[model samples]
Target: MDALDGRLIRLLAEEPRIGVLECSRRLQVARGTVQARLDRLQAKGVISGFGPEVDPAAIGYPVTAFATLEISQGQGADVRAHLARVPEVLELHTITGIGDMLVRIVARSNADLQRVIDRVVGFDGIVRSSTAIVLENPVPYRILPLVDQAAAE
Candidate 1:
């Protein structure tokens, strides 16, 4: 990724609805150049998708929590499949730490969170689990700084 790519990405991140022609105009590049760069970025998996960002809170599920799960021996696949079946399980990660897997879950309220947690760890493959509720999200997910650093390189 070059400086132009970084600038283009920053512009896109700010205004996701902007078109290629407008991006080219703002970046002072040809429309085809902008289009080609975007295509290349997508093909290389740098630009994953152009879909609208959806907030779980806006959709009625406001509470957020993380679950650390320790599964029974050789039951990783089964545990993963089981967790994937739950709608509230937003993200899952296999980690090298106190737990075998980490899951990000959401719920409508604190009471609803217990039900979600029960369903999450109910599978026989799961041996033990721990959970922590998110008090606040001072820094949500972002990648712009990395993008700029890559552009600098």
Candidate 2:
């Protein structure tokens, strides 16, 4: 992508709902140009779907924990599939570390957290799991940094 594509992506990443007309107005380009660029970006998979960012606390899950799991007897895919079916398991990653997988989970209460841990450990392939509850969160979630901006500067 060129500088113009970078600018368009940066603007859209900040405000996905901004219409083509408004983007064109801001960038001083024609509306059709903005629309065409956006369409091309989408077609190329550079710009994916735009959706809401919800707060877990507001939805009744005030607790957050990071879980480290060790799979037993090479239960990889099965463990991943089981975790995928669970609602509280927000994000799971296969990382290069001592643990087999790392999971981010949210729960309503301490008991709820225990239940989550129990359920996770109950999976056939999982041998052991450890959890660390987050006491405070300063920075939550945000979009990726605009790499295009940095390259230009």
Candidate 3:
């Protein structure tokens, strides 16, 4: 959570496949130092995984929607498991506002979205669901700004 750590994170984020040796060369630090920092960062859970980031739209699924689900009483676990089985379900979060759970889903088309929605709400534990299709994403998901702000501090 220092400048070095932030820089290391940004470096990796920009070049996920970059090796530790190259990182050391670019950062002007020893290879061992880069490795140690990376190890420490991983151990601290600051860096979760090195998996590739896939875009839903690029893979034929361009339609994006968010569904807010109201599940049956005490059916959170069951609902969660049911939702987990659905491949289109991208992210799920429990909320305290108007809905019990919020979910991000993707589909090949608007009509396909209905099928996905049906699957999402098929479980008996799910009471109701309200969906909103995404028109555009002016600002997509990003963390670099937060990283830079934290680094400056």
Candidate 4:
């Protein structure tokens, strides 16, 4: 990624609806150049997708929680498949720690969260689990600073 690509990504992150023509106008580059850069970015897996970001709170599942699952030996695939069938499991990651997998889940309420957790630990392979409810988000997820740093480089 070069300076031009950095600028283009920043612009897109700010205004995702802008088309290639508008990007070309703003960046003072040819339309083909903007289009080609975008194409290359996507091809290189830098630009993953143009899907709209959805808020779980807005969609009725406001309660957010993280769960760490301790599984029986050699059951990662089975546990992962079981979690995949659950709609409330938003994201899952295998991390090096006390637990085998870390999962992010959401629910309609506290009672609903219990239900989600129950489903998560229902499988035979899961030995134990730990959970923490998210009370607030002081610093939400972001990558703009990294993008700017990359641009400088």
TM-score of 1: 0.97
Where model 2 places Cα greater than 4 Å from the true spot, the runs are 144-153
| TM-score of each model, paired residue for residue | 0.97, 0.85, 0.97, 0.97
lDDT tens digits, residues 46-89, model 1? 99998999999999999999999999899999999999999999
Model 4 collision count: 0
Q: All candidates' lDDT scores?
A: 0.97, 0.86, 0.95, 0.95
**How many steric overlaps are in each model, in order?**
0, 0, 0, 0
Per-residue accuracy of model 3 over 1-153 as CA lDDT, tens digit each: 889889999999999999999999999999999999999989988889999999999999999999999998999999999999999999999998898999999999999999999999999999888999999999999988898898889
**Higher-ranked by lDDT: 1 or 4:** 1
Which residue pairs clash within candidate 3? none
Candidate 2, after superposition: displacement of residue 148 in Å? 5.5
Q: Between candidates 3 and 4, name the one with more favorable TM-score.
A: 3
Q: Write the per-residue lDDT of candidate 4 for residues 1-38, one digit (tens) a residue.
A: 88999999999999999999999999999999999999
User: What is the Cα root-mean-square deviation between model 4 and the actual structure?
Assistant: 0.9
Off by over 4 Å in 3: none
Among these predictions, the greatest lDDT belongs to 1
